[model samples]
Target: MSEQLPAPDPARFPALDADPSWVLSVPEGTLIARIFRAGGTHPVAWHEFRTFGPLDGRFDPHPLPVGEHEGAGVLYGVLERGRGGGVADGGALGGAFAAALLEVFQAQRMIRLRDGSPTLAAFEVTRPLRLLDLSDSDWIAVAGGNSAISSGDRERSRVWARAIAQRYPELDGVVSASSLVPDARVVALWAGAADALPRYPAALLPLGRDELIGVIDRIADRYGYLVL
Candidate 1:
């Protein structure tokens, strides 16, 4: 039987209160994963895992093959307590978990989200994603999709755009998955366009779907804290 690993701690990591966060610069056909850790502080971490050509009905629920452009994948990790910490030997536990996950990706031939959405096949892991400190209102502005409450209309867009600006006041503009504005500090994830929305001035992130997942696991292993 496989050994059970301890869960993450909560006191160290906190939960994300903001709804509708945005991930910008995702390459076309890339998969994004968002893992939400229950009962923890700073429970949110974004990872850009792998890139794949396309997905082939291996994973279920939201299975969609990669488009013409190379696709990328992302994952979110939330740390909760009951997990181990302060381990010796350079924390092999986390490294082992990451390696095992990679093996699974190769065997399954794809990565699936908690909702069972297909994201990536196989790729590499990138740098760790750190969420900047921003108010809940500002988070909603950048992360939240165009909704009845925060529509993408001229007025609403301006409102949302303003929120983003406030958070990263220093930024020239905001970029979202689909839209981009020069001198802005927000971007959205646009899978169809295979390109960043025009107007925003931030670096575009081109990655594979699987690469996203790898990053999520790493965060969960490294900084994830615990309680009790």
Candidate 2:
């Protein structure tokens, strides 16, 4: 039988009453990379604000409240803060792309990229965004939480996210180091930051597109993940 991982200390979870101010600024023109289903709730240029869920994402605010918190959408992306440029720059392999890919397909050792019309998109943040920066160890401590918030039980983590949303509703969303790729920062934007998305993506293409085939291959090869 698979071992049941021990739950993180409940005392270390973000306190419902703790006031935290560890926000990070994602500046205008910053590149955000994502891999999304073209036909899903989050199509290109879409921020999923309309639907709150009982889903399994660590930070998806469940039972999203009405009143002030209503229509508080969320967008997930990897910040293209890596050196040597991004995917739009000469198709160079970037940490953001690799991180995004791993986030979606890590459950399977072999990633079947063709199954979902998985599309890769690059968005430029149009304005400054303030996000709860949980990636920092000190910031996590300030919230009375630990690194487990970023890499722990999804159900329990969502409980913490709900607390954050209730305590700091003005926050755009949360930012954390990718659980799969610690060096690559990931973002989840709430509070309807759709204006942050330009009318058109900076770059958009399906993973199966001819130009992206090599990029996907390189990422899979570099990470020792099988691509089919």
lDDT of each candidate versus the true structure: 0.28, 0.70
Off by over 4 Å in 2: 1-21, 40-50, 64-70, 88-93
Clashes of each: 66, 1
Weakest ten-residue segment in model 2 by summed lDDT: 1-10
Evaluated at residue 119, the lDDT of candidate 1 is 26
Residue-level lDDT tens digits of model 1 in 70-185: 32332221111123321122232333223323322433433334322322222121322233322223443344332222213333343333244334322222232211111112
Candidate 1 residue runs with Cα over 4 Å from true position: 1-48, 53-65, 80-128, 132-137, 142-228
List the pairs of residues colliding in candidate 2.
49-73
Q: Estimate each model's TM-score.
A: 0.20, 0.81
- Report the number of the highest-TM-score candidate: 2
Cα lDDT of model 2 by residue, 70-118, tens digit: 5655567888775466653433236688788989888875767767568
